[model samples]
Target: MTYGKFAYVYDELMKDVPYDKWVDLVMKNTQKYNIQGKRLLDIACGTGELSIKFAKKGYHVTGVDLSEDMLMVAHSKAADNGMDIQFYQQNMAELEGLGQFDIIGIFCDSLNYLQSEQEVLDTFMHVYEHLDDKGLFIFDVHSIHKILQIFMNQTFTLNDEEISYIWNSYQGEFPNSVEHDLSFFVLDHKSGMYDRYDELHFQRTYPIEIYETWLREAGFEVVEVAADFESVSPQTQSERIIFICRKK
Candidate 1:
């Protein structure tokens, strides 16, 4: 979904997210797998946080996202940091004209935004086509257990002078799916009033085995499945599931 005004406040809302840990995860996996290449693609890279981090680490990074507004923010951030990262506006499932990369990532549970299983598989195939042979493909998703046990029927709220939001999560039509309804109140300093807006987002995820099967069908060899930021297999109540695959 297009982020709309949410793009402007995205970074602020995500200020506490562990972006450094994600970068470290990629670095650790690359080293462990003995993969040698500098080219990296960050798909669904919201506002270029991870892309900028990767660029700082000397990776030739390209950031791609479906929202023009998000890409605009990413481009501005990259330029502000004196970085030369290519930011593209494109759907992950229909990736095109982007050259091959040593690593492709869809972090931050971005793949869950896809509405259908076919979309996920199509994205995997396109990612495979854009990856170098034996290149790594890394992504994460909210685990089914987390979706059911935590997100479903949950309400979360945040308050700040500049920004405040009420987030409601409801069980979606499909299994392992949740619809996020968010309402934001941002203070207009000059007017001394708050502007309100609402955003709706839908996300779905499958069992780990289904993801592995789709990766195999797209000609990728599943290398590892880790939970959260750990290098161990996921437990029964793991919140996030990370998959590391290699183009074979």
Candidate 2:
């Protein structure tokens, strides 16, 4: 459950990600479905990046993540941008008491962190419970192909002005899973000091059919499954697969 230093540098390392595409896709779905309510809940909204964008689009946004450090950074960013976004620290699998939302989103492969079929089903059920009738539930996960082919034996590195990192991916001890061992060297600009931190994260994904089955069991009608950032069928070689569902 430790994000470690990656919790601090997550935004910087992911700066090149196409967050605008996520926003655009969500907006497009809202328009296509005639979803007019403004309330939105972003599950696993790490650092609240996409939540801020939704808020800018005139939606009342609430972001929930398990990491307090990430929530702190999210709060700072919201303050800096003069945005009124509510951030909560909670586990998605046990989320409760949050009133219904017109739309709920889990993006950036966040669902993979559940690491187990039961947890995934529980999370989906909770999401279903919290969504208003006929509401939209949009999420994306790393395709099984990506997990087996690209991430199973990958080593990636990133060097930046504030942080340098070595991310090593290995086959997980569990079946159909991957583990990430991340080492980060962060610099303190004012004090001229460097800090080293290590973190272990685990992610696992099932086939698209399994996800579809679980969504249906959780009271959602699968609306669409598309390639990442596009409303098209996902190819086998695609890295990410998106699922768009509507609550029954």
Candidate 3:
């Protein structure tokens, strides 16, 4: 329920996400797979960015996240944009009674926040239960390559008028895991003062084959695995990986 300041500044920091590409991919795959109805549940749908996009595109979209702070931001954005999106505060690992959907998405590297493989398997099982037969499940994850090559022992900073962030990534004790130490300096527009806040997030990724195996165990038919946002062959040295799966 507490996202601290990470939920508040999440959108600003992730302004570069290629949401249009995700939408395009969803549309194309849904059509190709004959997923007709528009019911969709976006797990860990931070701020409802892509959820609202689907709503605008005529999907009955529901967005769920663990952070009430993030859902508040998502609600405000939906109101501002005049989009009707149902945003729920819920954990993805144990999604319950969330009815069936023709499409389910877990994008934006949100799955990276899970700290363990058990959590991942539980989440996959929950998604399988909520998906209609042959429903499409599309998501993306931070590749192991990214954890080692890009984030390992990395220090990065972002500066802007409304918010500033210093992010440091360290190798986790376990293989294929990374820990993020984030400090934020957010400006209060009315008070003209900056408040400092901090959050620590842990992430780990298994091999691609592991995910495929788990998806199959969860009753999903594994489909294609593509690099990050690319549709075809992966670009050399890709840092992100995408999975397009279907319910069996």
RMSD in angstroms, all models? 0.6, 1.2, 1.6
TM-score for each model: 0.99, 0.96, 0.95
lDDT of 2 by residue, 139-173 (tens): 99999899999999899998877888899999997
Q: Which candidate leads in lDDT? A: 1
lDDT of 3 at 221: 87
Ranking by TM-score: 1, 2, 3
lDDT per model, in order? Answer: 0.95, 0.91, 0.87
lDDT of 3 by residue, 107-207 (tens): 87889888888999999999999999889999888888898889999999988888888999999977899998989999988899999998988888878
Between candidates 1 and 3, name the one with more favorable lDDT.
Answer: 1
The clash count for each model shown is 0, 0, 0
Greater TM-score among 2 and 3 belongs to 2
- Colliding pairs, model 2: none
